[model samples]
Target: MRELHEHTTTTAADALGEAEVAVLPTGSVEQHGPALPLGTDLFAAAGVATRVDRADAIVLPGVPVGVSDHHRQFHGTLSTTEETFADYVADIVESVAAHGVRKVVVVNGHGGNTNALRRAARRLRADDVAFTVPWHWWDNLDDLIDARLDTSLGHADAVETSAMLHLTELVQEDLLADAEAGAADSWGREVPGGADVGFDTADFSDSGAVGHPTDGTAEIGAELVAEAVDDLNALVDWLAAQRFEDLRPAPHR
Candidate 1:
């Protein structure tokens, strides 16, 4: 197949009689921090998807808008209701699978998008299309993510900022300052900046970061990204190894 996330080209692999995995980058156009773009979620996911495509997948256009209702407090943020987002994901997966492609992978960014991934996964499986999605920050690379933090960093913390810095050099100085100041008062929890600052979004973090951004560095961010890609490849390889018998659904009986 041509690739997971690339422009769909039917004949690309028609002669092979095997479908290649199609990867969709799921992300959001929401507030990240004072320094980053409103497209951080999409950008981050696309970054990984790009790498995955080069390595083994056919990368598709990224779904830039997502269910980011929690981040609606920020001006540039765009969100769809969960139902709507779920519908969009299903439609895309179904459309691609309709073309004789069955393996679909969604390289996701944005913590807010995980719920949609789960809902979409269950839905895709029900429809008989094999689908898998990385749960943004936690899929397959827990060690790398945790290595960059001391405690659980809250929003806009060291890990995120560092990743942004490493990935795109898109860090914002003023916002980082704001995030740090708020972290001190909010008890080190700040979910993503540019949106509203409130108790609901504030509950999980004190200064806005549940973990430590103090230790985040570009080197760590790059390493984490690499590890994430490796984990994703491993998943693809494992899936490819399964045969019809290997995937047999368990009998309810």
Candidate 2:
């Protein structure tokens, strides 16, 4: 499939009429853990989004920056106000809509961006704009993640690190080997005598890798990719069949 990054104006235009959907990867750059790069969310979303089998639909460049106000307490964090972020995203959809795309899929990776996108999508719809829905990877893969992961080295924990390992072998994980099964607890308590310290990724281990790196391998990441691609493709098919009002009776029905 041709990627948006590789297409000329004409090719891009042509794909619009030919393709049923347009994909926009939405991600963020902030602290994950010492073991993972700040761009982990961005790359993970990219890895999965690019793998979608949308024949004529080309993958566009992802939104690399996002609202990171929560992570602003950490170093090297760049965030934008929610309003600014929403405007930026709205502009993206509007710019792409100029093409023949009647449907759009914003593949969101960060947890923070979901509500904002929801609000924006609703507003756009209320204005009679044409578009598809925002699909959050975390929400979509909840069933998969729940079956595989427990509440342990979370946030910058096991699942995320494993994904990075699978997508790029060069990812930093020198400290992942020290993962502590349960770092922080949901009750706002800490695991007693855990190897980790304080931080979103802390409590799991000193360097912020949660659970066990021993449990993580490139193979698992590959499995996640397979599952994700399969499910997302199904979602794309469903999106293609949707109407602005599935609320009304269909002619066949």
Candidate 3:
């Protein structure tokens, strides 16, 4: 693994010079029910980012906190404002661009960070500082998730639980039943007019989880990670072959 933090300044200078893309993992330190650890998202993002064995890509240290105010009612849920998160992400990408690796792939693990990440990516592109793409591990895996777990991505659900099992041994295996017992059938509470009233996770789920947790298995998690890594490698291959100028925005007609 070409992890930037593991390299000395001298070694990093050479590594950065030869790298065409920088992979930055971003996630949240938030509640993942009783069975899963608070760092579940971070583990998933970092796991995927580090597994991409590409000589032309360098992995940066992960951003461990994100926009997770919706889970504030749960313990150990740390969060930052959307604006703050966006600025932080943009700054990181800008710093990487200063090192000459302007092509970046932000491997994201938290759903709440979507808007902030998008805003950061757009700002970086507009400023011509970097070309950043926010990629979720579960992106384009809806079919596999639904087929294996019979549910979409949910907070601390089977999909996430499986990932934790595969990447780390932090899961409280004995509490899997408890997590499922308190889990909500779906994400939020909606009215007949299609209005969502569940502002906080506590409003909808007592366990801060959605979907079935008992269905998760380490075997399935490994499969998910393998597929995600393949997808990331393909993306990096495509990025590494492109010229930085071609990726930049074109002038207005």
Candidate 4:
């Protein structure tokens, strides 16, 4: 892994020069429920980022906190304002661009960080500082997840629990049943008029989980990670082959 932090100034200068793309992992350090660790998202993002075994890409240190105010009712949840998160991400990309590596892939692991990542990517592209693409680890895996767990994605649920199981040893296996028992059937609450009423995780989920946690297994988690890694590598290859100038905004018509 060409991890930026592992390299000294001289080595990094050489590595950066040879690197065609940079990979930045971003995630939230928030409550995942009793069964899962608070660093689940960060670990997932960083795990996938480091697994990209390509010499053309340089992995940046991960950002461990994100826009997670909705989960604040739960313990150990840390959050930053959307604006702050966006600016912070943009700043990092800008700095990377200063090194002449302008193509970047942001491997994201939290749903709440979506807007901020998008905002940051857009700003970077608009400023011509970098060409950034934000990617979720679970992207393009709906079929595999559905086949294995028969459910959609949820916070600290089977999908995420499986990922944690595959990637780390921090899962509290004994608490999986309790987490599922208190989990909400779905993500949010809605009224008769199609108005969504659920504002916070506390409003809908009793355990801060949204799906069946007990259904998660290490086997499925491994599959998820493998597929994600394959997708990431393909993306990196595509990015590496492109000229940076061609990825930037087109001249106004």
Give the top-scoring candidate (TM-score). 4
lDDT of 1 by residue, 1-253 (tens): 2344333355545522354566788888876645566776676677766676443346667888987776665567788887888878888878776765566678887777778778887877765665555446336665656655544434566656666767886776556655555453233234576454454344443333333445557787787677777776666666655553445346688
Model 4 TM-score, all chains together? 0.98
Given candidate 2, what's the lDDT at residue 213? 48
Clash number for each model: 42, 2, 0, 0
CA RMSD per model (angstroms): 5.1, 5.3, 0.9, 0.8
Q: Can you write out model 4's per-residue Cα lDDT over 1-253, one digit (the tens) per residue?
A: 7699999999999999999999999999998989999999999999889999877999999999999999999999999999999999999999988999999999999999999999999989988899999999899889999999999898999999999999999999999998988899998899999998999999999899999999999899999999999999999999999998899889999
List model 3 lDDT by residue over 129-190, tens digit each.
99999999889789889888778888899999999999999999999999999999999999
Segments in model 3 whose C-alpha atoms lie over 4 Å from true places: none
lDDT of 2 by residue, 99-191 (tens): 756567888877667777877676666555546478765555566666665433345666677678888864565655443333333312355
- Candidate 3 TM-score over all chains jointly: 0.98
Give Cα-based local distance difference scores for all models. 0.63, 0.67, 0.93, 0.93
| Candidate 4 segments whose C-alpha is farther than 4 A from its true place | none
- Scored by Cα lDDT, where does model 1 land? 0.63
Best by lDDT, which number?
Answer: 4
